[model samples]
Target: MILSIALKEWKLLIKEKGVFIWLLVMPALFIVLFGTVLGNLGGGTQTLTYIDNDRTAASESLMTALGEQGGFKLEAKQAGELDDQVDRIREGKLGFLLVVPQGFAEKMTAGGDSLAAVELYSDGASDSAAGIRSALQNVATDYREQRLDAALKQAGVGDEAREQALQSPLQIEEKPQNATEGNAVTQVVPGYTVMFVFFVMISMIRRFIGDKTNGMTARLRTTRMKPLHYLLGMWLAYLGVALVQCAVLLGFGHFAYDVALGDLAAIAVLVLMLALCGTGLGLALSMVVRSENQGMAFVQLITMGGAALGGLWFPLEYMPKSMQTISHFLPQYWGQLAFQDIMTRGDHLSGILPSLAVLAAFALAGVLVALLRFRGFMKSAQG
Candidate 1:
């Protein structure tokens, strides 16, 4: 009997043209659009046009160090070409330009309070330009240390003493706790999937309201069907729909964008938990609203507000600390955490158990609220 009701709900959902378009089509479009547009926005190698005015071995060594750092593409030009290079940078034809001043090698070799300064001009807005600037800074630091070593040698200082002098007094070793290799596609796909899954609530709630207004619920009371069976059937149907929606989006992400589903079992568990969260919220919402307009208003508030605060549109790391703190109250935040743990961090199911537990708690709360309100809601409709 429960299967029969569940199948009916599924069939009705499938027959709705709008549901098919929103659930399946729109998510795929967003994944492609966002993945392609913002995929390469992060850090990478940059090209710098440089004029070595100090045509000395020291300047050569600096350039070699910059090249060895592997963060810049060096384009050597004549010293007289500085004006032309600046023009190219302004015109967006070039990213950055470096001028190694005359006597730079002499100043570096002298190794005193006087320091060799290389002039770097770049578009501050470009990420590539920023990378080049950082690389240049590191190269200059290394060159300064080398000069110190040369000075020590001239002063008859031992090799070990020179090395000890050059070594940093304070050192930091970075160890990543999570193995998540974040990519544009991986970040976006799961986020949108969670956003759209919650969106399914609108349709599901509307369906429940329709059954009430059209006397379907009252008619069912005359049959052998218990209210528990009816409610369970609806929950199962919506849960199934949500699962299918996730599967389609994830499958598309895997095949089209080559997104790795790190720990498939963990991903599956997260998807199921998210589906439960959506289903329970939808059912609870269906019982509360008195009209279609109110239900839609709630849907908009829940789906959009949840997605925005939950880091569905962008990473929480980019948000203000307060905003990130507020996000913890939203179920979508936990869902994204679980998804990111598996998709990005390559964490096993055990690693994401906390997020799963939170989502399950949310689901339980929503179900309990809906069950408590179910009787009153039906009575109000009948009256």
Candidate 2:
């Protein structure tokens, strides 16, 4: 019975080219788009106007670092246009403007510190400016350190002595604990995969709702079948589709984008677990919403909400401690973390036990909710 129902759902879903394209093809399209834009255009790099009032070697070096560091692209601007530049920034014509004060080289050469002021002129509500701020600060700090080191060397102090006496005491060495650890894009890939998968999968639920509303469910029920049996089959078929979609995405990341996807066996396990959980989630959501339109709205909202809370778009490191604490309640967070551990960290299967357990719990919870909802709807139909 379950097999028959599953086959029916599979055929029904296959007939809907729109839903199939949205589920399988659209995500791949977006992944290609993500790779094209983010890979070529540079990820997280900001464009700032470079108003070099002082064209000294130090300022030049700073500009070079900003450009070479691959964080911000430095654009030259006239000094008189500083305010207008700010207005342009506010008007969305630019990101921000940087100004190097006059006499910067003389002060540095004379052993006096000079401030290189950056005019971060953006209209109110630019919290997205956090990344830009961090990048610029890093650029500025590098300039100061390099200039100070050069000055100390010129003053006959050995590099070792200058470092011991003046340089920061902290020496932080960043080494990737695993293959994908040091690579920013690779580390975030899993989060993106999980986020978009959730979004696309949930969005596909409109097909199920459409079927239910068009008397398809009633027509099938006339064959003397149980609701749970039919639901189980549909769940299985969708789960299979979800698994294939995830596998294709992972493979593309590995072969095309050079994203280190960790151990194959571990990745398979993660995808399977997530597919199950997503299937149940999609099914339960489809049952709960009243109409196909309402289902689309609800799924869109939930998908975005889950991804936002789950560190999909950004790392949780920047979030408040309270928000971080709350994020654990989201299943997407755990799923991404699990993928990260497996793919980025190259952890053994045993290392991801906790996350695997959590994912299993999510799958169980979602399935229970879906089954309960199915039961309720079935009883109403029988009555």
Highest-scoring model, lDDT: 1
The candidate maximizing TM-score is: 1
> What lDDT would candidate 2 get against the real structure?
0.72
lDDT of 1 by residue, 1-383 (tens): 78889999989987899998888899889888988777866545566679999999989888888898885678899977889998988887887888899999888766458778888888666754666677777876776677678878999999999889888899999887656667888888998899999988888788889988888888887789888888899999989989999999999998998888889888988999999999899989988888888999999999899999999988999999999999999999999888888888878999999999999998998899899999886665551
Q: Which stretches of candidate 2 lie over 4 Å from their true place?
A: 33-170, 182-184, 199-208, 224-226
Give lDDT tens digits, candidate 2, residues 1-383: 88887677678767878766766576666666655655554455576677888888977876786677666656788788788887876787665666877876676566454554645655465554565667768876776777778878989998779878675778999865665544445534566667656654454466566556666776777878877787787788788777877887777777877888778788888888888777777877877777777877877776778888887656778788988887898778888888887777778678888878887888788778777788665544431
RMSD of each: 4.3, 5.1
Q: Each prediction's Cα lDDT score?
A: 0.86, 0.72
TM-score of 2: 0.73
